[model samples]
Target: MFPGPTGVTTLKSWPESAARLIAVAAGRETADLVVRNGQWVNVHSREVIAGTDIAIADGRIAYCGDDASAMIGENTRVIDAEGRYLVPGLCDAHMHVESGMLTVSEFVRAVLPHGTTSMFVDPHEIANVLGLDGVRLMHDEAVDQPINVFVQMPSCAPSAPGLETTGEELGPDDVEAAMGWPNIIGLGEMMNFPGVASGDPKMLGEIAATQNAGKVVGGHYASPDLGSPFHAYVAGGPADDHEGTREEDAVARVRQGMRAMLRLGSAWYDVKSQITAVTEKGLDPSNFILCTDDCHSGTLVNDGHMDRVVRHAIECGCEPLVAIQMATINTARHFGLERELGSITPGRRADIVITSDLATLPIEMVIARGVVAAEDGQVRVERRAFDYPATARDTVRLGRELVSVDFDIHAPEGADTVRVNVIGVVENQAPTKALTKDLPVRNGLVRSDPTQDICQIALVERHRASGSVTNGFVSGFGYKGACAIASTVAHDSHHMIVVGTSKENMAEAANRLAEVGGGVCVFKDGKEIALVELPIAGLMSDEPAELVAAKAARMVEAMGECGCELNNAYMQHSLLALVVIPELRISDLGIVDVRRFELVDLIVGN
Candidate 1:
């Protein structure tokens, strides 16, 4: 049941709840709460109307106009806004709760004060580690929250065919079964663009299942080339895409009837470039949406959540009202939640944000479902924490303790100089560049060249504990010291990724995580410097957001101390194993040439 008095959470129950809503709107019944004397940011008319009052009953908006005196009763809770702008609560169109390193409830507790009332989360990261059971655990926790947390059934568990191997694989039957869930909004982003273009049966079957169930199909076409492959993938029935990084990418998605989601996360600053389609090119802004595809605990607790994205969009020359619409009504309309919780209209949920200014968007008070949930960066209401089962914890299982020899990159039979394909990291973006470097072999093994910022990266199989380690070289971390950074939060496959300048330190970092369940660790000079223990599915921490944020901040500091200065380098580190994205990536199987969608040899004879 919904937290509201009418006890209606789904559209199926709206028929029985309509009588009370209609009665309060007509002034025949008393409202439960009333907000007087505020300016309404009406997204329906795309205008800011002054002198507005909202009458709320049974946790739904009954009336919103200049006068609501007739609906006020003796028991109604009256809140005087004092002429603040009553804006609709923000909505994150796309995100992953595991990215925040917090569970669903803690994520809600963290973002509620930032005026985000709704989130469309894709749990594909955890799904790769625990399969359908993981999705069910997340879905059950999401539906119990005070805010709206819609779950998207993960479309691709391995994310790409023949590129990476995951612990659990999901098929079309899994997609069809998740459709019957109460909170499953749609299928998650179909990251296998190559499979979609080539008419792969499994990929097409999953998309058709979502479509047949009348649910949205999310897309992730990361390629910049908008060629026939892009057209073929679009023709395969995906509705919305968030992988656009350029203005043309946004324009192309909208031109093809897909919503172009502009994202501004901790590391991915894609909004400034893509939002130019609306600000400068003057394309239709209605088809544009705003989101944070991935964010860490530090960004959520320190900078802001949706508020940071909206403010950055405004700084990128978007009008404040237009940016707010992208975050609120546009996102709600895209997910078919416009009538439920997007606006301050009659029949929508009573979710309002009181702000002193439109340009800065200072959140003063947050009203979610007619209850004052948060005010001034703190939650006023209490939310219970979810206790994860022990089976979900202690997921790190390495059959044997790792050693420096496991990370040795053996040169070909008689080669002295080896030409290697390196995964080059781009700062503040998701894409990577494939670089080649020729280095001399030492003792018949290819060694890392720290002077060229080339470090060794290995993907250790953590799920099966086969003790398999695939090693490769990566650039752009700028590490100059004896250090290693290891994480079990690798995207899509959720394997253990360790990047280090020294193989000894890499072995030390990996063993530390295996000993302490699962976590992110930084080892320097054969000593552990910083660590953030996840211990839950090897992905998220069950601790409070504040404690996790503190630990994450130290991890960032440790990366800096090790001579890596990229912003949110841990996010870039975790995605190195994601084989769906372009250029190059590493997996437990081997090094993958993502552009060719095949496994490639790490070293070429020179």
Candidate 2:
């Protein structure tokens, strides 16, 4: 194999290797590899043609037709497909690698067996903690992979400018500098949708830099109101969006010339509700793409990746060919990479998946860059772990040990009972509901009402070592005992978020993460039940995916034991501090009313 900088297969430019490819296709040169007697799932034409053969030279498809036997030489390696379907390798249109609690290399290793050969990753989660350097780290590691892993320069590090603060900040200059990187696909999801709609110069400058570099701009318009703000956001130059949770949201995005990404992550089940725009309304399927926005390691190892999304789409009333098209060609076309690696077409990278069924979509074998990367649900290649710098670790700086008294919320003067705003979690979705509940006060302090399912939530500042803790109330996880969970992997802004019914348990959870540098920990009745150590930027671990997934499974079980019964409750817990999505969230600043885009008082006085 022709190795690149880090032992990855080096793909020569089409111009540099065009003559060899042409000669191989014309039977004038020997082919390096040949796959014969397979049914090709043609995404471009939406047809499955039988008796197909493909010829490869220098890690790219040189010829694909009914027969390529003429190009095969005595030394050429051949694989008999045995009447299997030769489908293009699947692509994840948008995702975050850090969400898996594994590094880029580990994440790739975990999903390669699932037939995902192409991924458009947004490393904004790390950017929120380590800034541009962190993005560069992930970008460098991504290019060293056997498959295609494109990085999008993070557009919003803090996510919301004035609403929250992070360990690092990325601006327009950073975006411009990153455009010159070899693997940068475009600007990451513009999480600051309000900033884009209001013509914020910083948001526009980043968008302009991406456009000026001739790259696609990703979007995250996380609002249900598709009114003036949504239109303004579209006008600001985001080529695609993956935050649509409704059918109208998908229709609006496609109608406005933006690709709509239907996602089925570990927690977010959005494909069934939004795919109707194409399957039912008769809209073009080319504008709809499938993605896993944020899947944990447990989901990647125990379940599947893009293959799972494709199967789910097929089960959601979409045709098998149409779902495959949505996952492959549609995503490639959106990112302007259709000519490079989307289908079983000549002159493209030789990334194909051999499967026996279309609807079930079992990934029997996966070939990436003309090499057998995985077969029979096992990776066949070696992937080395990328060593992160020491500066990237030990990021959980809580300044001082947190105590139970620090979490106490003093009641106003002498109020016996007061109504307060609560963040209501919506299962299987990103958006939360703004809710209110009345609670009794004892001894001049407000207490969480376990009977009403209301618990205390805190966002502890970990970046500046400020020792600042902002407290709020959230109702959704039906926890019964004195259970608390703490995580440094909070979205957009990687602060420490602790949610629990008991102040003492919450303190213990938060202090444990700070002691371990960073990670997610569950504490019940003053005992640590589960912990997943993520020493890299306090967001990811370099350990093997199986080990991490095992720990994550235990964490999930612990949540269930604590009386929390939400599907993927850990995901919902991690996103509580995401101030971009409505309608309520907590941050280092204070409790944010996302609907109004301002900080609001916690108490409702009569």
Misplaced by over 4 Å in model 1 are 4-13
Count of backbone clashes, every candidate in sequence:
0, 0
Model 1 Cα lDDT, one tens digit per residue, 1-606: 375312334222345558987898899988888999999999988899988999987677889999989898999889998899999999999999999999998898889899999899999988999999999999998987777899999999989867777889999999999999999999999999999999999999999999889989999999988999899999998888999889999999999999999999989999999999999999999999999999999999999999989999999999999999999999899888878988999888888999999889988899888788899888976765677898788678889999999999888878778899999999999989988998778899998898788999999999988999989999999987799999999998999999999899999999999998888999999999999999989999989999999999999999999999899999999999989888899998888888888888887533
Look at candidate 1 and give me any clashing residue pairs: none
Error of 2 at 403 (Å): 0.6
The TM-score leader among the candidates is 2
Q: Model 2: clashing residue pairs?
A: none
lDDT of 2 at 74: 97
- Quality of model 1 by C-alpha lDDT: 0.90
- lDDT tens digits, residue span 248-340, model 2: 999999999999999999999999999898889999998999999999999999999999999999999999999999989998999999889
Q: Give the Cα lDDT of each candidate.
A: 0.90, 0.92
